[model samples]
Target chain A: MTTTAQTRAHDAANLGLLPIFMAAAAGLTLLYFTGFAQASVYHDSAHDTRHTLAFPCH
Target chain B: MTTRIFASALFAGLLAGLVAVLLQWSLMEKLILEGEEYETGAKSHFAGVLKLNEDGETAEQAAESGDGGEEEGTTRRFALAFFATFVTWVGWALLMVAGFALTERYGVRITMKDALVWGTAGFGAIHVMTGIGLPPELPGQPAAEIELRQMWWITTAATAVIGFALMGYGRKPFHFAAGIALLIAPHLIGAPRLDDYSGMAPPELSGEYVARSYAVAFISWIVLGLAAGYFWNRLQQPPA
Candidate 1:
């Protein structure tokens, strides 16, 4: 019984799928705006950011 | 645990954002404004061709008039820039902190020094890898289709990140080879390009913009990694 409980605790402590998936989603959302969003939407803002951070957008 | 990580990330993010905004205000803002001036036709690279005024005014007088517009406001631009920088840094900090927790959970030893390395790798994957294909562009610059550029940028950054991960964490020789392959994969499939290179801004302006942009990015990422690591380490420890 103790062994089983310990195993369950270990699994719970492991970094699981949810955080990883959420991070990916957040990353992709940012990426869309930074790299792929329509220029008409936020072109100036993105353009300024691209230059400030030096992301090669040209 | 999540709250602690986020708190650490938010703190680091705010600090990094401040650094980015200050640097941008001091270093890059002028270059961008000049590029815009050319893009909007307020200035011209090619000489000898007079800017014809619909009002039949002198070229110099017309140029002066062109400067006034809905788009012309330093205050607005700076405000927007500050907000964007802050949010962006916060996002990055969250990712960095999460990465630290993930690594720790996976049994890898993490340290402040290691975080610095992580920061460099982040810089490489996010900026250097993608930038290899698409260096910073300025206003009035011609570009290929946005869809294609986006596809390539995502592919490059993804592959680069995977490559770095494998190389850093994989223990086997095959893993190393696989990591190397991933690193080269994006470059092998070159980035999309325009059939022609053209932009209203002068070449010198673009060059300066690219150089300065890289310089600032390199410095900022280093700081971000260090700060994130320091904060995460401090926050995660039990009180004495």
Candidate 2:
């Protein structure tokens, strides 16, 4: 029972790094589109929001 | 666990984003639209006072002129704003949740209170720290080149984030001092700036816009923190 508890604790702590990396990648991509994309369409579309959120905008 | 984290992030982000967009529409959109009038020359600051038109047309008179086919454009813009804001919040949520997970791996469990602290750190890094060099701007506000400003803004935010992380996690005095230094380094380097400060919009209007934007951002970020924390706790509970 002690061994099982230890193993469960180990597994719980070992939540792995992959999810963190994947989430970071996805998050950065979305942020780029909303806040930093240079395309005129993106700019025009997100103009007010970009300004409202204090993102750099034309 | 991964799926749970993502699910928590998505739900929290959606809730926060909804609140943020509603707040934006009610509190901030009008200032932006008014600023755009100056930006597009639909209303001119000088024209209003000087009566620049041959027919003595004031800026208010010019503004009174309506644009055609704006209904379609307004609808499109509104849709875009909604989507962008939602995406932005989700992105923030994902990043924050990932941070939470990473910290947990190092033996730091994030409670709802801890999540609120993280959210404040986020606001400090992304909004307050960056805004020190680059305050919120109106549509017609003068600025440096976009690329340069963006580079500085990103650098400041990254440094601030790292700095905050160190301060939060580091046990040593050196580490804390290093974090403080990192926090100050970007400001010391300075943000890119225009040679002259001239804007189409009046200064009072611009001031109000900046103030209101910060107010809105603060409230939204607090809500985001609470929502993220609540969801994070809710999802992490063991199945009954």
Candidate 3:
């Protein structure tokens, strides 16, 4: 394989680390704001989402 | 190649988002509004003094009277829902594409059929397996502390994903056994739960909520996976 092709393949093979970790961080932030944040500041914003997901909220 | 992958991923994400918005609207929105009524003291599951006294009428009667149907704004709610759905599926699509790329690197055959299986596995890891411990909860339901519940939820998802990865890519007997171990580990640890199930929402409502949530997750993940796979395959084709 040409150097460029090998490099591209190598990058693609390991391509997920950044995206995966970023997704995890974003997921955690959304989960926190939607699921666990203090009621007054966070509850209303996530109300629709929480219900849509059927998460427990009182 | 990079541009193709991103383009496919973006389109798949948007498609999944639209599907999710439609599914949630048709299936879960009413249940949610009803649950909200109960949560906000506009209704009660069991008839009693605790029930809101709109001229001593029941919740259903009060609702029929039009005293309860006056929501502040629905347009805002739907717009937010669409945005959230779009963002979430996009993130999921990116992850899905990355996962496929990783598997391809390890010599696993990538095909549309195989992508469907991957989609199922993704559902299992993110929603089904984790939900085994923490079934969807309704409004006004009591729950374990958020920290503990969140911890268990993340752990379960992580364990399930690793287990699935091993099962798909592992070559040796030891790898297989280890994969099985990973799958079972989270459940053995158990999800955090409330000591008592006391809550304002009725048991029946909670039951329905859990079932519907699982149903939606199953459908959404399947479609999302298939669509992503289809796009990826199409994009990978060489120009004529």
Candidate 4:
């Protein structure tokens, strides 16, 4: 099968300069955002947060 | 004097991204959740409000699934968005410079009209399409729950038709308009239903939101691309 640009991958190009910077920034920023497994609710109300798989769920 | 950049590009790209997310939330999230919310024949159309730490259950009564399998979903989404942002931005920017330079050398010099076209196609079109297929919701939802139901490729055809046309035509403005059309068209067609919360999220909501997101992203990238392209070209130029 002929290789197409859409599916082709280039290791060097894959981590281009802008992406490298953006990812580093985003990762560091995410570390600061703070996420946890759970929080409590007073009355069985639906607003309470729950545990679910990360990104894997959606 | 300092060079000024167009605000339109930045605004458009961010708008596009926002619209894409909103569309998923309003329309597809629920329908997607509805099918997923059902854990058993007897109960749970949705899971809402986890007591957490103490253990709770749902898909039978989600006020908004403040947390559930959706936690997993949200995390994944965050990662995807982060990665998409990082990758697409660099990949497209590089491609854009190459494309523009090629055209200038062979076809025509980069112009505002051309800017709109290519930007829409690259930054706008690709993303909006991916957004359309996403399971709708703000941060939480289920992957298995939001099954594509054999409709996965529905967007593929749309992408090819639109992608190629814009790509093949290759002028700047036409590419831009086509890019906008691809983003806007599905919303106009009405968003996919998010039947999860029963009546909480309205149908067509997902598509509309996605449309706005596309608008924002397109605008933002165009500004970035244009500035970067022009600067790079000048830096590479020899004394004249």
- Which prediction has the highest TM-score against the true structure? 2
Top candidate by DockQ = 2
Error of 2 at B141 (Å): 1.3
Better model by DockQ: candidate 2 vs candidate 3: 2
The docking quality of candidate 1, as DockQ, is 0.42
Can you write out model 1's per-residue Cα lDDT over B1-240, one digit (the tens) per residue?
556566877888788878888888888989888987676566778976554434765556775766676465667777776676776777777777777777877768679889899889988988888888888777668788767877888788778878988898889988988988988888888888887876878899899888888777777788888998888888775634
Comparison by lDDT, 1 against 2, better one: 2
Ranking, lDDT, top scorer first = 2, 1, 3, 4
Q: Which 10 consecutive positions of candidate 2 chain B have the poorest summed lDDT?
A: B47-56
Instruction: List the pairs of residues colliding in candidate 2.
Output: none
| Residue B196 displacement (Å), model 4 | 9.0
| Candidate 2 residue-wise lDDT at B74 | 81
RMSD of each: 3.2, 3.5, 4.4, 13.0
TM-score of each: 0.86, 0.90, 0.81, 0.38
User: Candidate 2 on B48-165: residue-level lDDT in tens?
Assistant: 3443343455555754664666778888888899888988899898988888888887878888888888888988999999999999999878899999999999999999999999
Q: How good is the docking of model 3, as DockQ? A: 0.30
Model 1 error, position B138 (Å):
1.5
| Model 4 per-residue lDDT tens digits across residues A1-58 | 3455544444234323444344334433332222111122211111111011011122
In angstroms, give how far residue B224 of model 3 lies from its true place.
0.7
lDDT of 3 by residue, B1-240 (tens): 455456766788788778877888888878877776776567777776567643776566766887443665676676676576666677677777767655665657468888788789988998888788887776666788866877787788878889988887788888878888998998998988878766777777777877888887778788888998999888775634
